[model samples]
Target: MNTATASNFGVAASAGGPLLGDAEFQFLRDFVYRHCGIALSEQKRQLVQGRLLRRLRALGLKEFASYCELLRKDPAGELGELASAISTNVTSFFREMHHYDLLVEQLLPRWLEEKKGGGRLRIWSAGCATGEEPYALAMVLAEALERTGSKVDARILATDLSPQALEHACAGMYALDRMGGISDERRRRWFLRGEGRYEGYACVHQRLRELVAIQPLNLLHDWPMRGPFDAIFCRNVVIYFDKPTKQRLFDRYAGLLEPGGYLFLGHSESMHGLSDAFDLVGRTVYRKRVS
Candidate 1:
């Protein structure tokens, strides 16, 4: 993690305690998991408290339970807004560049040459926040498909639990500053620079933008997409889930994947004890083995 990220985490930890008591923390934990498929751990106590302090104060409820009750009874966009408020949606263009490199250089070629039956390729970016990962995937796919001369159709399903996050993802707009590590050529090819009042920002091109379908999907809830995805990029989202929830989640992911489909998880996450359904494929990648 960078210095800024570490500082943010540190400040969040310090700022969280008084806002949420032990019982409130537990309630928040359950509520988050129940709604979003994120399992909170003991280590997350500070993080949760820190991230949600604003919500606690804004709701005018002194206790977590009271706040939760308000959320439940909220008839408007309250529940969804609550998830949006507490959820962390930090993302950047090509944040984990290696994963995309692996896909373009290695996986695409292998899949094209070897696979005989299905000419359709599906990729799911579960918990895709503000659309960076899926957009990157689309660019890589377009490039790879151009090179291979294969007519196989490709689609990217980008889903997040937060309505606010999904709204941003659909907009496909991002600050140019956030494109720090992205190359100049890619920026020129895939993004349109902002003008007038919106100057200094960039938005994805319509073609690349069309490749992704954004939706508000709670991973903890029933999955709406019927997928035997060629790849599922569900990175960084599961780090907050507890062991049991993680295990069950892995199983569900396994079920969604085509036999031999790939699963890429967060850098800090491991499948060590999660499930027997997948074969480790290095660096947080797993292959859903044909049964």
Candidate 2:
């Protein structure tokens, strides 16, 4: 769900810096489908053209064909950058406050009570961009553990496709400006404000980092973990995917979730006609129906 921007990458390219042509565009369209599970339409051609320019410039290539060749040679390596070129990863700490509200107000307390005797409690941040979402989850989970004095073996699995994003997530640092969604009390509790040369940034507390395991994952590919997770947060990720892809993804989620596990979607995303494994319960919140 996350892609690496051009700023951090250097690619070599050749001559004739013309616009992205038909044959090359078609190759990209087909390639995106095969690798990324996205169906690029004619309507997106202009937008793709504009975005590809950034990739080409970042790669130091003048020709779109050169970029295509790069993809042909190393599709897995370049796929993330190309995806990022096309769609920016827009995420923030507590981006959708309501989702956190559900976790804080109901889910956390309930789960802690159930697992208090050192039982495992797992939650997955399916497309955790740059660590915000999972770290935020850690904050609440930490508080819940202390409040109830629970002995739960709790952890948050934060994963994304973009290597850059996962690296940033691993760093667990953020500019102070990005702390808008975090309240002053929580801020003081969970973040270490940077000073001197590191001024204007905040590093997540070591405790929070321990609760989150950051990892690289492309949802379209095979997953490495077998889980009966209690909840999964995959917000704002599948909007670009076609129906079949979405359907299969939802099915897979159903497979991994604990019976009656929760699935939270993005504000604009819906499961209507896409999945019947879960029942809509709250604002974009779904519960796996125990069969």
- On lDDT, the leading prediction is 2
In the range 1-291, model 1's lDDT, one tens digit per residue, is 676875443433343344455566677677667766566677777666655667677766565567767756762356566667666777877877788888988998877766535577889999898888889888888777778887677788999877778888888888988888678988998889999988999989887876788888777778877787989998988876788888988999999998899999988889997799999877888999987
User: lDDT of each model, Cα atoms only?
Assistant: 0.79, 0.87
Candidate 2 per-residue C-alpha lDDT over 69-148 given as tens digits, one digit per residue, 9 for 90 to 100:
99989998998877667766888998889988999899999988887666789999998978899999999999988888
Score residue 181 of candidate 2 by CA lDDT: 95
Model 2 off-target regions past 4 Å?
A: 1-17
Clashes of each: 1, 1
lDDT, candidate 1, equals 0.79
